[model samples]
Target: MSPTLRSIVCGVLGLTLSAAGSTAAAAATTIAGEAAPACVQYTAGWRYTFVSNGCDTVQQVTVEYRDGTAVPCRTAAPGETVTFPGYGTSGNEVLGVVLCGTTPA
Candidate 1:
């Protein structure tokens, strides 16, 4: 991903982090970290996962997060694992977006 795109993503992720704070706290996560690919707003808390395809500019990744709950991310492929920790259903919340790619695109 270009530096500009990375920055934009990070900026947006920052906002998402801020917005998720209260919810994270309520869920006992407290927004403790930000996944890398480093440039998007697809962030999650301790008990959450957010993913994105930073390298694929045209490839949009659409992650599914319901009520901010982790969606059993094990199905995530290699590059897909980055931007978010979609390691699978953990009872924790999951939040992220995917666009483009045919599969986890």
Candidate 2:
């Protein structure tokens, strides 16, 4: 083939390969799933509301504190609310909550 035609074919092939690679990369990087549990902040602490969403009632919920301590899991019925009090000074505490029997993400 002529050099010009060869260059054009190579350029088109490169573009096509790059486009396909990018499409696959985009799909692999995408992160989409069901919504997370609803939570609200109150004066003393945080409240998490669990929904069954056609699943079993929330049997337990856990609260993890900033200092690597976690409160004992407590039973929470479907559509029930659980609270975790704030720690540390006015606004420096961190709390982590996880719900059992929750709908998967």
Candidate 3:
């Protein structure tokens, strides 16, 4: 990621963390509910990140990057795994995966 984008992302994350004060517990509960269809990064290297969907339902997710870019949303069946390429540049990293939606299996 470029230094500027990295700084912006860090700043945003910091602000989000600091702004959650008393709502942290509520936010955690909401997040947990929303994360039912979660996809996690199982392995990562310079070139790729492997994401796995361990939920009981089909999940749609997108791979976000540190450079403020993202891969197109993809659907993964329960217990399925997917691979996403990195930004392919020095200092750029995969931020994480975000759930887009879910469907019954």
lDDT of each: 0.47, 0.48, 0.64
**Candidate 2 lDDT over residue span 1-105, tens digit each:** 999999999999999999898766544543333333554222333333222222244445554455753343445555555555456453444444444332322
Best by lDDT: 3
Give residue 88's lDDT in candidate 3 (0 to 100).
76
TM-score of candidate 2 relative to the true fold: 0.36
Q: Which ten-residue region of model 2 has the weakest summed lDDT?
A: 46-55
Off by over 4 Å in 2: 1-56, 90-92, 99-105
Angstrom error at residue 15, model 3:
40
Residue 53 accuracy (lDDT) in model 3: 84
Please give the lDDT score for candidate 3: 0.64
lDDT of 1 by residue, 14-69 (tens): 99998797555433422223333444346666544555444544333444555654
**TM-score of every prediction relative to native:** 0.22, 0.36, 0.54
Q: RMSD of each candidate?
A: 16.3, 14.8, 12.2
The deviation in Å at residue 12 for candidate 3 is 38
Better of 1 and 3 by lDDT: 3
Q: Give residue 41's error in model 3 in angstroms.
A: 3.9
Candidate order, TM-score descending: 3, 2, 1
